[model samples]
Target: MKIVILGGLGNLGSQLAQTLERDHELSVFDRVDFDVLDENALLNILKDIRPDILINCVAYNAVDNCEDKKLYETALALNCELPARLAQLALQFNFLLIHYSTDYVFNGLETKKEFSENDTPNPINKYGESKFLGEREILKQAENGLKYYLIRTSKLFGPQGGSPQAKPSFFDIMFKLSQDNKELTVVNEELSCFTYTPDLAAATARLISSKAVYGIYHLINEGAVTWYEGALELFQLLKQKVAVRPIRSEDLTRPARRPKFSVLQNNKVKKLRPYQEALREYLNNL
Candidate 1:
């Protein structure tokens, strides 16, 4: 199968490219290669390549920055418009469209039950709003005979990607901070799952290969934790004795409102291993 991956040089995209290349013919494009919003160019590529699958990984995911109204349009463009266009093309080209979403789409209120895929999104921030709308855009295309897989994951942590704009993962940020400061502060609120890119890539490959029912799926590492807990685990793994302190979400001066408990429950597919296992491997490799 010929698979075309947009934003292929970024963190998750790069992992997907690495995981999928072994079994499929792959073509990857990132911001450095061309403007992904160029419809004419994209259509031409679609026409020429006639890929079996089209995967879109591009997103304006600077959560706090997305609150700026000046950047909101860019967020809408990348998160909503682009994927909708790709879904349209997928319908025309008779190819499967694979897109990723986030756990932030939920309200994140405290709950004993994990969030299943059936729950309607009530995003609390501009970034989540954009992503939620993006999911709806693709589903709108789905209503018009588009085959798609919208997978939602959270708190990604792994190797850095090739793009200049690519930000380090949450765990990576914590690791870096530990080097400079003995005492690090992380939010104890906003408890959510952390996804390992390699694990997510593997699960995605399985989903694609199986051609499972096309709708929404939650793919994430198998644990729910807060930023403070995650930071503690990361330090414990690296044998770093950094003094980590807990802070509330309200205490932090951020532009976006975070969900208090946005843990995704993966009910549709085979579950991945625990985040601790994945994180251990990631640290060992590093």
Candidate 2:
């Protein structure tokens, strides 16, 4: 299959490119190659490539920065408008649309309960709202004969390092702080699945190749943990004695409201390994 991966230089996209390229004809385009907000350019590229699958990894995912009113348009353009246009193009060009979403679509209030695909979305922040809107746009296109797959995930980490064009991930920050032997404080109140990019990339390849049911699915590692726990595990894996502290989300006072528990339940495709196993594999690769 011929695949076109947008945001192909980023963490998840990079892994997808690496995993899928083994069996598929792959063409990658990052923001430097073409702005996702540029509808004309995007359509032109899709027309030129004419891939069998268009996997969209592009997103404006600066969670705190997304709360700024001045950046609302930018967020909407990348998170919602881009996917909608891509869905339109998929419909026009007869290609499968695979788009990534977030667990932030949920309110994150149910700590003990896991969120399923059937749960209704009630995003609490602008970032979540925009992502939810993007999902809706894709579904709307589906209603008009667009073949699409929406994969909602959370707490992504990988061996590929942080996205150069985006903010560093939590794992990156914690690992860097460990090297300095400085005390690191991570939020313990929030809970979600920590996904490894390579595992996700593998599962994605299976789903698309198998021609599974075309709808929303949650793709993440099997278990769930808080940021503090994940950080501790990372330090232990590296055999580094870094003093780590646990703090509440409110104590940090971030610009955006985060869901306290947004762990996703993968019901459709359960090919991903456990979070700890995936993390260990990533560490071994490093």
C-alpha RMSD of candidate 1? 0.9
Task: Please list the residue runs of candidate 2 whose C-alpha ends up more than 4 Å from where it truly belongs after superposition.
Answer: 161-163
In the range 6-108, model 1's lDDT, one tens digit per residue, is 9999999999999999999999999887899999999999999999999898999999989999899999999999998998899899999999999989987
- lDDT, candidate 1, residue 243? 92
User: Which 10 residues in a row give candidate 1 its minimum summed lDDT?
Assistant: 106-115
Candidate 2 per-residue C-alpha lDDT over 1-286 given as tens digits, one digit per residue, 9 for 90 to 100:
8899998989899989989988999999887787778778987888888899999999988889899998977899999998998998999999999999999999987556889888889999999999999999999988898898899999888866245775556778888877876788888977889888888888899898889999998999987899999998988988888899999999997899999889899877764788888888877877
Q: Which stretches of candidate 1 lie over 4 Å from their true place?
A: 110-112
| Residue 275 miss distance in model 2 (angstroms) | 1.1
